[model samples]
Target: MSKIYVLDTNVLLQDPHSIFSFEENEVVIPAVVLEEVDSKKRYMDEIGRNARHVSRLIDSFRGNGKLHERIPLENGGSLRIELNHRSFQQLQDIFIEKTNDNRILAVAKNLSLEEETKEDGKTVILVSKDALVRVKADAIGLLSEDYLSDRVIENDHVYTGFLEVYTAKETIDRYYEKGEIQASEIVTFPLFPNQFLVMKDALGSSASAIGIVDKSRKKLKKLIFDYDHIWGIKPRNVQQTAAFELLLRKDLPLVTLTGKAGTGKTLLALASGLLQTEDHGAYKKLLVARPIVPVGKDIGFLPGEKEEKLRPWMQPIYDNLEYLFNVKKPGELDAILAGMGSIEVEALTYIRGRSIPDQYIIIDEAQNLTKHEVKTILTRVGEGSKIVLMGDPEQIDHPYLDAYNNGLTYVVERFKDQMIAGHVKLIKGERSGLAQLAADLL
Candidate 1:
């Protein structure tokens, strides 16, 4: 049976093309959702861009038929703009506020009642990204669900970029002696390009070796880089060691790192970027950029130039740089950065519409970005450039994004099979024991 889906404003803002997602079902848009989307169209962020796109998409539908009436969609579903059902009397006992959320719920509830009176009763569902809106919908005895079209992977099943295999004691010894082995000899399953392996002895022995699949040679080679230390910072755990190998590789142009705070995701990326750009002269510059998502209460419209204003948002980057460079005194790091002239720190906002060539680009806090935004950033990379996207998917600050749908996880899942791309999920938190416990238990 065809269902009626009432889309919330956040659903449209999260993905402008959500109207066409429900196939062979009726999509209802309350007038209040358009009002909310209109109010957000003036901002200069991703949400605002999506709101404007949604308006354009709605406008395009008008040429076919009246949106207020049932308009046939390409996917066999119908679209309608609901102007009535604004009455809040039905939900007055449950929610007193006549806010946009409440108004949306009112329309959904009204549709539900109308559907129940039909001879063939159809389901009326409210599709929203807002948790509170979905909760209120449930309180009022309505069916609601999250917009799951954009989710790339489940949290528990996220790719860890490495696997373990048990081999015979002679095979393990031969691998250690020769420092390489055919992938088919180790495991019957096909291995992804650049995928790391933990080869253990099958005789219940303690011998083991870390190797990565070299797709070009079709062989598993031992790690070449010294993981004990890189640019004065050492990998505290095996996962970090795996991440470092991905970061320092010149063959893999695209690398992604996912971990909670203090897992050394950003630190490892920056350390490798600096090592290649400064020490090895492999790239022209080390460019660091991150999304400008605010935490807690936003500090609106600070007084200063671009760099001065960005100082607050980019402080975490500076802190990591200071630790790597060992700048203890005030203004010391700033002086060094100024003198070196090889490092550039900017917001992701200004990164658009430019081709960056021969640079080691690091985009931090990438979990807050959508898939389209990440695509834009990746397309801007010019020839002979490497880009590293690092973030903790669980710590997303974007209201519309979750652990599975954010850009970082999206890239990790989409690029798992590609030879030029690699990913590592850092499990250990080197920040402190307290932080590690909190990440695990809390």
Candidate 2:
């Protein structure tokens, strides 16, 4: 049975060409959706860029046939604007104001009624990115679904790089005595190379050590813990330990980490970069940059050079640095940042057209990056360079990106099976007690 998929404005804003995703079925764009798109088309940021893209997409279809009328799509679906479904009479009876949500719901309800009246009884489903819209659709007895057009990973089983194996302590002891052990010998569980193993005695004993081995049974050396324990930045669980393994892997040219805020994604990356660059001399320099996607609140523009303009967005990166370096005075960290031009901090805009070699590149807030933008950044890696992408998918500020299709998640999903690339999803909160609580509650 051909189903009618009603698209919300968010789906269009997220991906301008989203209408083409549904094949061999009817795609209905509620009239209110256009109004919402029009309202967002005048800005100069990502949202406005997407709105204009949506406008251009809708305009392009007019050349094929009249979009306001039922037109056949190339993929065997019919595209049409819902003209007869703009019934505000039912909504105005309940609320005096004509809210956008109610208008959208009214359009969906009218479409559902029209489908029910048809003899074939085809289904009408409302597609939206809003949770409340789905609830409202359910209230009106309409089939509703989240616009999961870009989800990469299935469910929430994100990449956690730690594997726990329960074996005889003698098995681990024999491996240490022999200087190596075959991965197949650990029969209790499967293992991924470069993955840290937390071996516990199957006999209910408490023996565990973090170690990494390769397919050739060669063990990589571990870094020494020489600093004060990061109290608010402890790994909450094994997932974070797995995240640390990826963060510390110098052989992996590309690394991606995703999780919620206060999950220690940024802190762990910064800590590992510092250890590898300053202490271990693994990489020549540490180059950290984040896409300057403004949060819900903007602090206005700064008047000065590029560094001054970047201060606001780069402050979080600096905060992690200041804490890691234990700078007591105000200008102490700045002096250090100035002295070691080894640490290059710049905006993503300036990183284009420059090849970075023999350095550790960390791009924070990568979830806000576009697919094209991410490709541009990744291609700039020179020989002996490692790039790490980290961000929170749930807190995206870019209008055209989503949890599934955002550049960060896109890179992680596309390169997951590759040996030189690794990904870790940090699930624990280690920023602070209140921040963790807010992260969990909010």
Candidate 3:
């Protein structure tokens, strides 16, 4: 049965094309949602861009008919703007204020009642990305759901790019002797390109080997970089080993690393970037960039030039670089950067509309980016350039993003089948025992 879906402002802001997502169902837009979108269109961020796009999309639907009335959509659905001025009387006892959220709820409640009195009753559902909005909708006896059309993968089933398989001890011995084995000889399931493997004896013996699926050869080959350390930073666990191997490979141009805080996601990427750019001179320069997302309350704005203004937002990147370069004093790191002239630290905001060639680019805190934002960054990669995206998906700070739908997760899932891409989900927190416990319990 076709149902009515009332979209929240946040839903439109997160995905401007959400109106077309519900097939053959009536999409209702409350007047207050447009008001909210209008208020947010003046900002200078992704949300603002989406808000403007939503307004333009709604405006384009006017030629079909008045938005206050039902207009046929291209996808066999109909959309209409709910112009009924609803009061908070129905929810006055529970929510006294006549805020925008309450007003939206009142509209949905009135619509539900109107639909119920019709000869053919239809379900009215409120779709929102805000958890509190959904909870409030439930408290008022309104059916609601989270807007999940943009989510490419679920949190529980996120691809880790690695799995364990058990084979006979003889097969393992042959693999070690030949240094390669056909994938069909061991596992029955299909393996993705560059998918790492932990081959073990079928009897659960101590014999095991680490290898990766070579798509070109259709065989499991040994890891390329199993060094004791990559520029003094050692892999404390198997997942980290996989991450380092992916990071150091020249064949895999795009690498993604995910972990909890202190799992060495950023540290490992930076080390490999330095190893390739500074020590080996494989790339022309090393470029480190991250989104300028504030964690807590915004500290207003910093005064000075562009670099000075980005100092606070990019301090975490600086700290990682200092640790890798062994800078002891305050200005020592600056002197080293000035001397080398190969490392560049910039915000992700200014990276658009430029082609970067032969550079080792590292985009940190990538979990805070949207799919569109990440696409824009990736398309800027010029010839012979390598880009690494690393972040802890569990610690996202973006208001409209979460663990599963963010850009980091999107790239990891979409690129799992490609040979030029590799990923590793670091499970162990090697920072400290207390930090690991906090990451687990808290």
| Per-model CA lDDT versus the true structure | 0.91, 0.78, 0.92
lDDT of 2 by residue, 196-305 (tens): 56677888877655556453434422322323334335555766766666777667888888888988888888888877888788999999999887878877878998
Candidate 2 residue pairs that clash = none
**TM-score for all models, in order of appearance:** 0.96, 0.82, 0.97
Instruction: Indicate which candidate wins on lDDT.
Output: 3
- RMSD (Cα, Å) of candidate 3? 1.3
Clashing pairs in 3: none
Please provide the root mean square deviation of candidate 2 (C-alpha atoms, Å): 4.1
Error of 2 at 306 (Å): 3.2
Candidate scoring better on lDDT of 1 and 3: 3
Q: Sorted on TM-score, highest at the top, how do the candidates line up? A: 3, 1, 2
lDDT tens readout by residue for model 1, 1-442: 9999999998999889999999999999999999999999998888899999999999999999889999999999999999877778888988888888898999999889888998998999999988988998898899999899978964469988888899988888899899999888888877788889898888889988889988763799988787568789888877888888888989888999998888989889999999999999999999999999999889899889999999999999999999999998999999999999999999999999999999999999999999989999999999999999999999988888999999988899999989999988888899989988989887
Task: Report how far off residue 180 is in candidate 2 (Å).
Answer: 3.2
lDDT of 2: 0.78
TM-score attained by model 1: 0.96
Question: What does candidate 3's lDDT look like per residue over 256-358, in tens digits?
Answer: 9988988999999999999999889999999999999999999998999998999999999999889988888989999999999999999999998999999
